[model samples]
Target: MTTQQDPSRETVDRWAFADTVESGSPARKPGVRLGPAIGAAAAAALVVVAATVIPQIRKDPLGAARGTVPQTPTGAPAAQAPAGQAPVGQESLAPQQTPQGGGGSLTYANHAIVGPGGACCSTSGGAWTAAGTGGYPAYTGPVRTSADRNAWYEWNLGRPASGARWDQIKIRLWIPQAQAGAWVRITVTSTAGSASNVATFDVAEQEYQGWYELPATFTIGTPDRRTGSAWVKLTYLRPYTDQAAAQACADGSCDRMAAAQAEFLWS
Candidate 1:
């Protein structure tokens, strides 16, 4: 009678034979031979599985090893801007500067020509022949004239635009001929109640001839004074002297007067 061998022992033997074949061993045991067809089918199945899984592993080896794709933490903070810098799309809080005027020559709104003896040259200074004739409105003392005669060219500058402040004020004068110790006094008045601001400029000798600039300074206040109240006066002080009278009135023509031009700066 054939003895029924242990089933567990047979299974162990079959596995041991398969391990030997995988290790390149050509030896086989009697009655424990594996079928050639079965071995080929198993190898084909392994090939199909390797073909499908190896490409995926090659694509993402780290993810395959970790068994999951890497991800950012949901609670991580976002990037921030540098210190003292505004964020994107944020409005700036710093003050901005807006400058106005100073484009061209400044125009006068009102003018007055006061001749010697405190007399008005015309009913309106604008109607005078020498009001804007590009010549200085001046009077010369005759020889032996005792009184100190003076002439004035008063002008009112237009008010600065709303929300604008004065930056600088400059006056240009053309001195055709020069005289010894000849000078003009410039006075600026902002309001009726405010004191006048004065500056003296010398226009004597050849060095003082031609175009000369007279810079003047005055306080317009923090909020500025009332509009249409600012004015400037150019006074030609003619003192009676032998030398001045002889030189100025010798040719019967006092060409020592100046042509005035003014410019205003604002911001």
Candidate 2:
């Protein structure tokens, strides 16, 4: 009993004696205290951790609380049109072009010799001859006479493009000054039996000698597919006079009544 008590009491007495002797005062509690350098280093480390974690939490508070990264929403791409095709609601609405010419106009040369209603005119006596050396290749017809007071010249303009709407019709002609009071009537007819209004051109009103343009409003139907053509008829309607009869045979030449070309203008 003496031996066991002595051993335990000796251990406790030795720790108390050493603390009291080293400090030369009452023994202090056994604990650790931080030095100035270590305390500052620990405080800086805590500041660095707070700075890094606080920004992350501020940027995405819910994500930081949930411990997950935030996700962004993505949108689908837009639709595109096929190659060589127009986009929807952006299709072109321009009028179709003609084969003869472009720029909203169609030109045709007058070369046929047949008149309207299959009526034949005498071409043996040079009544209808090419107006050679007259700038444009035109055909000259004899002046209207008592016997042949009405001469209808026809031009077979080929079929216009489908749905073509011509606003103006033009004819190029040459009328001599001697036929001052003579007149010509222009009309358009299709093989589909559609006809336009009569357009009259009077020499007395125009006073044109060499080349002149006769324009008219075109409001009739377009060319038909039946014959694939439109007929432009120029009727020379003038009462024969003694002066016209004398001037017709002057110098063995008929008065120059020529038609060169015809045109259809688009709106």
Q: TM-score per candidate, in order?
A: 0.33, 0.33
RMSD of each: 30.3, 35.3
Task: Give the Cα-based TM-score of candidate 2 against the true structure.
Answer: 0.33
Q: Which stretches of candidate 2 lie over 4 Å from their true place?
A: 1-127, 135-150, 160-183, 188-196, 204-206, 220-230, 239-256
Global lDDT of each candidate: 0.41, 0.42
lDDT by residue (tens digit), candidate 1, 138-201: 4231111111234455645454454333322334444434332234455555533443343444
Residue 18, model 2: Cα distance from true site in angstroms: 99
CA lDDT of 95 in candidate 2? 49
Q: Tens-digit lDDT track for model 2 on 151-267?
A: 445555453454433433344444434433334455554332354343444443123454455544344343322222345555555433455556544542233343434443333
Best-performing candidate as measured by lDDT: 2
